[model samples]
Target: MSSPVALIATAKLRREDIDAFTTWQGRHEAAAATFSGFLSSDLIPPGKDGHDEWTLILNFQTADQLTIWQHSAARASLIAEALPFFIGGNTGQAMAGDTAHDTSVTGVTGMIFSRIKPGMEGRYREWAVRIQAAQTKYPGYRGIYLQPPATSGKDATWTTFVRYDTRAHLEAWMTAPERATLLEEAEEFVDNMELVRLATAFPGWVPVNATTGQGPPDWKTALLVLLGLFPIVMLELRFLNPTFSAWNMNASLATFIANALSVAVTSFVTMRLFVRWFDWWLFPNAHRPADTTLKGLILLFMLFIGEIGALWWLLP
Candidate 1:
């Protein structure tokens, strides 16, 4: 079977057009949903005081299905309708393989677009490999995905997606003197460059630190999610399931409702309360003491045990 494919589309819009652009994008997404093999889509807006570029990622079961959507009249019409809101024409590239379809990707991603000077593609590619190798030595480095311009000919823009474990770690590499030297070296082979930061993956699950722009690590976040979710699941299985059965609700419908409630409660209530109480542990300072970590783990463990004990007692 073919690997799943993700189409990454980017557009630049003026500040004044953002509201109108978002409305148009909603319609565009609605149209895309009707197409075959559409798995999911994520629209990432620019950050506060950040650049004007908006990114849309559409995941499809196969590249063929994505190609159909790309060439469909519905998409073309929507693109035309959206032209007035765009500062420039949009650009898109289809990415396949492991990195593109990596569902577990979290933290921050830097999308770097570089335009190579005429006749310098070969040399620029060699330099890209070297810079990627250099970046691997940095702390919290995840991986990088590179894509050349979707269409051939005069457009020589290369898109590079570099992911790091956190915003602080990403910024460290971005501002490092070694990277600056590499950028300076690329002056001969590069004509222009733009970098956009995307802090997505699991939005609204964990609040980012204002100063660091970093959230708790994935493992910590997952553990907290389990801490909140376990009781919710147990309670629903105990109380909600019986009530639904008494009401004669369809099995599928009950499952859907249960999931919706789980997500809503987890995102809005449980996570917010837990995050507030665990703020210090969640967003520890760079030099956080070992005891701080140990204490936080002990507290979390105790909470889990208490929840289990109470639920076991009450459920029966």
Candidate 2:
């Protein structure tokens, strides 16, 4: 199923009211924890500009599911609790899945952001570091990274990376009582922040895997293959061209070089196009299935074979 992307933004009401802000935020977090379809919320800290802004990025199964939370009584209560802490206000946007939205084919990636009180920034980081380390022992946990907010700002922010297997899986994690309580605890450190979620836009197909463990494509291998093709191509083009000039170079080493280059280029292009397409249609954590990868590679390789065969038949 395709997941809808949510972009949520929030900021503080006052730079000096950290204690009151944290208290109100804790209750607000509690309120959000009660909602359904609440996959994961990211609390992004204010960046270099000292904006005290926080972003919550969420993934949901569909717009309908998101609407449930949008219209929920709990959400109303949460907002009311957060009203006094609201500094700069908040805004949200939800994009419906088009042909390009697919998380099942391309992995989706997410980052969590939060703004800790100025003097409490180190404590907030300590909690995140320890909690993330403990969470890594769980089944769906992949890996994580951290980023600190600007020190020059009135509000300090921190960011962390989190991964899950699917939108459903992420929702399940959020729905847990333990997880909700952790959110409440985390809220105690922040004056105000937002949780913003984003997914790449692709058409029609969803990603199959969303785990960070799958790793990115081996660009080194692809680059080596391209580098290796150069010498072969030059040898055939320059040294063997004279000897096979009568046969249009089809019988010469250049033909092999050309075939190899074609294969390598085609594979590289196909992989990139596929990744780009998947990024658009699916979440960053999503992945195309193993069979899907095989099928794509086969199709690419066949195109290469056909090109070579056609050249042999027509030119020679």
Candidate 3:
């Protein structure tokens, strides 16, 4: 199972009151633990954008857990204490929570895009690699992928990918001198630019074991068996014998009908087996601990229903 994740909740704060907000944040973390479903939290200050705002990224076992924390008295008190000093506004206003799909990532993937000038694409890539090498050398860098310009439209763009032990580490990386150099070198290629700090927390299902292993026992296998038998059964009941009277035909018809009925009955009986096997083998039901296992199980069951009932029809 992947680790359950949450978003980096951002809010702007006065630079003078940063110390005060930091202190309050520590207290809030302690207070938060008292609430049900608490996992962990981190404090991130403003980086290259050069603002006084700070961001707090939190993680929980599930959306239900976050809902509980939001309404907790401690959470209310903490927000009340810290709201007055923010610049981008308060947590309850600018901040919104998006549930994560990839529980593998502790926090969301934040991306910033910079475009290259017509002739500077080659040099821009050179600087990008240097920045990436520096970034990869750093503790939190995951890996980077660069998407060059497609044949049709705008110039090429550059992206950087970094992982953080905490959001604080990420914020620090952003503000570091190497990033400043990257930004400076980037200006040569860039004309009109855009930066986006995204939160990749939307939820979805993913397959578990794709390679050699005992796969899940589900209706997929049973359905395959039924499909294979369909042609053979039709031939046996309807076309095998050439000589037969009307009464003989009626008896033969009865035997054919009985065989079809048995097949349908067996498929219906094994439907649950299919669901259980698929749910267990496919989705990230084990990402959280055993105490939260039931919630994951329920989520997987819903996924199974959607897949077998709706998705099958929708897909080609």
Candidate 4:
């Protein structure tokens, strides 16, 4: 299923207000948790650029809950409390999906922005279903997402998203003769078509350069993920095993839940910590080749040493 509806907002913080802002943020999140349909939230701190901005991503189970929370007195009071910490007014965008919009670019994703011909909605949808099925045969195909026109809108514009593990894989799908034929098939149904790569700032453990609004290369992302996840998983396994054993729950289900929580912690807390610690390697001439590659190799070597040390110290 898709992710819950969410309001994603970012505040430019006063340099001196960082601590106070965090305190208020924590309180605000706690309040939000009390609301119905509240699922999860994450606090994204500024990057190496010293941007002084913090992002709050809040998720609720439904549009109704999202609206209620937006207009709730609790939320209003929290906003009023946070005003002094803001260097600038907050900016927000509402989105719904399996993951937050910013995080969706962890892989190479393509957006197909199209408008249907008037009175052709029925046929266009049929065509879309067929194309979606065709795409499943492609290698590395992750999934497709569809966003219809807003409520009560006449224009039949549709935003369709497709994702694959790598740009090369995505390109293969796009440039394939099969895809070309499919586009020809869809030409009359779609009045306008635009394809572009989605750029992202931060997704998860991967460092997406803030300045460029682009994610790090795949190798860098993989290595950094390993750097963070290796220790996190190991430590969780070592310390959490006893607690899991004590639980009356089925062992398989217990293990699954424990691992899931471990990953959630790694995504929301652990990665942010490493991003700050590895800022130098992540953002240095991020656009240039060899620069990041060389530095990533160095960090990877360090990670190897850290991994060995962790196993020695944490393992029985």
Candidate 5:
């Protein structure tokens, strides 16, 4: 069976042309939907404080279908219509599989776009390897994925996705003196660079507001995670441990199984239920009274106590 595919396209636009570009983008999406095997499309606009680049992701069932859409006359015409609004011509990269819809991401991600100077691709790649190595030495470093220019010839743009466990950890890597030195050295090979930070406590598990591109704050997410996780851990210790011991499973393997089950349960069942029940608390409106936060905290505290009390009775 063919793997799913996604095309991620980005365009830079001037401030004044945003409205026109948005209207044109709607037409573009309409045109794309007419193609065969098209699954879905998502438009991520620029954040309030970042680069003015808008990203559009298109998912299709197969690469052949995506190729057909890309090479079609309808897409060409739409691109031509939208070209006037672009500051720099649009660029795109394709990833195989359903990466576009991946929600298992657990940290902050930085999307870096760099334009390498002519004939410096080799040097830039070498630099990338070194910088990647340097970042791995830092605390909370997750991983990085790099993509070369989507098109052949004069287009030298490269896209990179770097992840760290939290915004503070990511910022530590980004603002470190080592990174600063690397950037200084890169000046010889790189013409321009842009970094966009995507902040989310639990990306796929927690919904991000379309306009704001943000999820609930980290503290709230942590508290919710604890609330959901505590019961699971307690129940595992009470019921699952004896079964594992009976099966002669070692501590390491038993612990691994327990963690895996906990993560799966939290991700699929508990998190969803909690998010739904606490939607108002998770995303209170801007004008919501301050006590709204306190009220939610109090409610959570009560739930914690209730869980502890119930488990105490059930276990012992």
Candidate 6:
């Protein structure tokens, strides 16, 4: 896959036309979702100070995917349809820049849009680097994508992409004591903030229909996770623990190491593969749902049988 790209557009509106513009924006977003490579999209409403106007942010899996969407006739049709509503003169150009997306970035992302004080761009960027470095030291930290204020927008704005393995870790860093100090240090620069979480954790990797909604039901997710994690846990327990035990580590530390190793295996290997196998279950829309419930029930029963068999084999 190509490197992911952060594409943002800002539009200024006649205050009275906000409602009409928003309706058009929704249709536009729906159209964009049909295309391949689209990841997630968000809209930031204009602020009280009239700094940002309105912003539409989009994430694509690759630059090529973005280009395909950008040059598509469908996109052109929508823009043409909505041109009349841009009475306040669109400021979208200012909200986008040549922001680079890192291909290696996988997992959930936190898309943060921040507007800095007019003269604070340099200081804001410096502060951003420091905070990202600090966050890197924390667990689940993946990487970041920063887009500078566009030359055509109404204000000095920046978009930061924060990738994390889980929401818990993301929240931890956001609420950490260090973050308080970091925010204080940047108080002179940041003017406003808008943050949108990118994806539901990993079970979301189930490539279902293109949607922004939460992944399948909690029970479904729990079942799928259990399916993916169980064998990984069993295999590691059977083979890997003895290797760690040779180091004569304490029971608590040894268990921790085993857990960490197994979780890593689950996240990167098993879960990735299992999602494909369960794609029909995850994305019922892609296939007929006539017997989905039956399939799921049968699979659960099979898992029940397998568990008893595996236990019999390993117990001795």
- Evaluate model 5: give its TM-score: 0.44
Q: Which is the winner by lDDT between candidate 4 and candidate 6?
A: 4
| Span of 10 residues, lowest total lDDT, candidate 2 | 200-209
Q: Tell me the deviation in Å of residue 291 in model 6.
A: 3.3
Where does candidate 5 have its weakest 10-residue lDDT segment?
A: 206-215
How close to the true structure is residue 27 of candidate 6, measured as C-alpha lDDT? 58
Which is the leading candidate under lDDT?
5
RMSD of each: 18.4, 17.0, 21.4, 22.2, 16.0, 16.8
What is the per-residue lDDT of model 6 for residues 1-316, given as tens digits with 9 covering 90 to 100?
Answer: 3566767777777766665665665556556655776665555554445464566666767777787888899988888887776755442331223344544444567666788887776677566656755766577665455555544244656777776777778777766778767866765777765455434554434332222223555566567678767777777777777877888778898889888887787778767776667766764642376889679869977986797687667623
- By summed lDDT, the worst window of 10 consecutive residues in model 1 runs over 97-106
C-alpha local distance difference test of each model: 0.73, 0.48, 0.49, 0.66, 0.75, 0.64
Candidate maximizing TM-score: 6
TM-score, ranked from best to worst: 6, 5, 1, 4, 2, 3
- Per-residue C-alpha lDDT of model 3 across residues 61-125, encoded as one tens digit per residue: 56667777777777888788777866674463212343322234454344455566777655664
Model 1 TM:
0.40
lDDT of 5 by residue, 1-316 (tens): 9988999888888878866775665566557766787765655555445556777778788999999999999999988888888887455688997655333545788777788888887688667656765776677765455555645455557777777778888878877878877877887988767565445757667775322335678888889989999999999998999999999999999999999999999999998898878877987755578788889999999999999888887576
Clashes found in each candidate (C-alpha, N, C closer than 3 A): 0, 56, 11, 1, 0, 3
Could you estimate the TM-score for every candidate?
Answer: 0.40, 0.31, 0.30, 0.35, 0.44, 0.45
Q: After superposition, how far is residue 199 of candidate 4 from its true place, in Å?
A: 3.5
- Winner by TM-score between candidate 6 and candidate 3: 6
